[model samples]
Target: MNLLEAEKFPFQQTRFTRTSDIQTIIKLFSQFSKEELMKKNQEVSIAGRMTGKRMFFADLTDQSETIQLKFSSENKKFAELDNGDIIGVVRGIVCRTDTQEKKNERKLSVEVEEFSLLSKCLRPIPSSYYGLSDTEERFRNRPLDFIVNKQKKEIFFLRHQVIKNIRQFLEEKKFIEIETPILVSEASGAQAKPFITHHNKLHRDFYLRIATEIPLKKLLVGGFEKIYEIGRIFRNEGIDARHNPEFTTIEVYQAYENAEYMMNLTEELFHYLAEKVFEKEKFTFNSHNISLQKPFRRLSMIEAIKEHINIDFAKINGLEEACQLAQKFNLKLEKFQKTVGHVILAFFEKFVEKNLIQPTFIYDYPVEVSPLAKSKPENEEIADRFELYIGGLEFANGYSELNDPTEQKKRFEEQSKQKELGNEEIASFDKEFLEALEYGMPPAGGLGIGIDRLIMLLTGQNSIKEVIAFPQLKNKEKNFE
Candidate 1:
């Protein structure tokens, strides 16, 4: 930024040293009485941006904390100080003060005996109250947003702690972390459109991974009993409150475990995070008070439909009848959704999904929509898959993985047909993943949670953009000089 009034204040400090920060000073001397501090007379060096009103008393803030600074207005250097100036307080005495301006309240502070202007804040730091009302403005300029709205720091702090505890929880269970490739020949694993890029070296097109599931599953096939990946996933899709083109997900797999076992694991993970990171079972998200303390409610897809809409879907025998039911509910069916299974899912999403405000697992997803999941032994039409929903958004998906190569091939063919029928988001027929399954991978369960959405829920953020620091925005030319 260009310096405003440059000729007035020249030669800002190139480097300055400090012995203590505001937080350390407060921690060390806040307990002592006024007489005790006067007797001890601790001298320290500190530096931070000058925040708040500046007369004799000013608040100097660093990342750790903010502390008061008292200076003489008569001192020419202090007299010329501006709010937002980066300055160092040299040989400052830790002291206590009482003032009528503070309603006779005693406050711990520091007396600024000597000072130095470390840097002249070239651009005026945006006003804390009036200047940052636009949401887009705040997002486009995150650094200024952090300075103006200090409370925003807590969101990221929670984000860090949440991810840290996730590693801790999974490590305690002996789950190894493996980073998979970002660019791949096939963006298979979950059904989503991929961001395609050409590889000049290989002379073939590659897609950014839409999910970490395929490679992590390969690790499982190569005989890692338990493994997980916290990874960035790219999808060629629209951006909205819950959807980002690039997002994060944690996909975990365990050998010799089934969908039911994974369901239990998902619940335990959430409960552990609630008690461990947040230290509470209740959280407010999207205007709902969700509790992780209770056992999560579980229901089959058809059961969930019945519970919410009083419609028993199991009795709907054929596509014609299902189509009629969709018509009755005013739900439009796309060309690829011309099956009983697809129509059942359509009905569930339209009628039941939003009603799952608290933690609820709706299982027995249609095999048409869940190609990687094993089919229930008794019901080949239904996959042994479940999705955990909270605050009307799907937080986690888990299933008993399909290990039979032949069945997996059939499912891939089904998905290819769906893609031909105008469904852009369908799993690819990954040749390598199929080859891995042919080696007889043990029957296993896999679970995936969108880390961004989970953080949004835990932190009470309504939009995905709030949790992410640099969310993508529409193209606009910079007109700045």
Candidate 2:
């Protein structure tokens, strides 16, 4: 049959009920299962690819269903029907069944009487017993993976469920979902490198957004009290099991809400998704079980570091001393440590982060590392920021957004100094974003959740690739030793 013709094939309008045309239905397949014929002597039409064929005592037996299809073909024409052919139009008596002759296994057999070829297969399918195993090939050709692997298909389906549930929950909360510019003049908002593209006609450089935080905040300034975006973000960074150059993130901004409220929202979102998606009220990470019954753990940055390693970062002498302590903890130290705050963050990441197995909010990070978060009321040196981590993976980050243009300008200047000192990832000041801040954005709570990482955690996938349809890989031509 022509491929296009097969696509346009109309229904035959044939219906085979149990008590009608029993002989005609039984003869459809080469073989039938005992249970196949045990259906109360009913006439049924079953169609599928022809798989196995055999001949016993001059009787052509086709193993289509559980029972052996014993039929008389003078030249053994049924055996010539190649594997994968869609052939079935059988009439058989439905009888209560068992395979007594075949002692190895028990199967119901259908007594096929007459058969017809609905469609013939010119080629055979891949062995169902041994499936496509090459990981890269499977991803590159995902349709084949879906055809052969039920588990692989289910993974993506679960991913879809996770995203859909999240969207529905946010929508029910009356947050207006918005789409912001993926291509922007300046890559402000988060401290990450962006992919630069040029507009030939405009002769200007545009960048893929590193985070939706800034644009959503801009909308907040524009009088939209609650806004959110589930967008694709690009970061020019190293690819790892946890990090991808191109990833998905959900950013939300709620005006008049503080970092504390954002933290609660984050926790509730996770718990809601977990219960609805995984159908579980508890999650186990690294053999440590956590009950998702209600509220999660809340730990300050200092408190976390203090609990993990008895160090009071608040009491540290200065930058030099903090640097020395960071060095002692085996954290990477670059050229200069202008702020002790950087060292404090580096230490917590190295010593304390890997131990936070259950859901915990590590908050009040040093201001130097959190340029976009508002400073704490009692302490100018600490910013009101919180990061949620579970399964030793950082899932979400939230904060009371810094809306003071003057303070933001100072932060940008500090970041510019670091850039001058050669930190490539420090973001450039977007004049437009600053102008938006000057227009007076509300004291809003903003969130950035790594959708890929969250999917990985929820799906029990350890690597980013398991969740991502495609992940970044190093160019084979690039030389690195």
Please report the candidate that would top TM-score against the real structure. Answer: 1
What's the C-alpha lDDT at position 122 in model 2? 58
Error of 2 at 202 (Å): 2.1
What is the Cα-based TM-score of model 1?
0.93
Instruction: Give model 2's TM-score versus the native structure.
Output: 0.78
Give the per-residue lDDT digits (tens) of candidate 2, residues 312-431. 987889887887887787778765345788888887888889998888889999999999999999999999999998877788999999999999999998888888887878887878
| TM-score of every prediction relative to native | 0.93, 0.78
Off by over 4 Å in 1: 1-18, 129-131, 476-481
The 10-residue segment of model 1 with minimum total lDDT is 1-10
lDDT of 1 at 333: 92
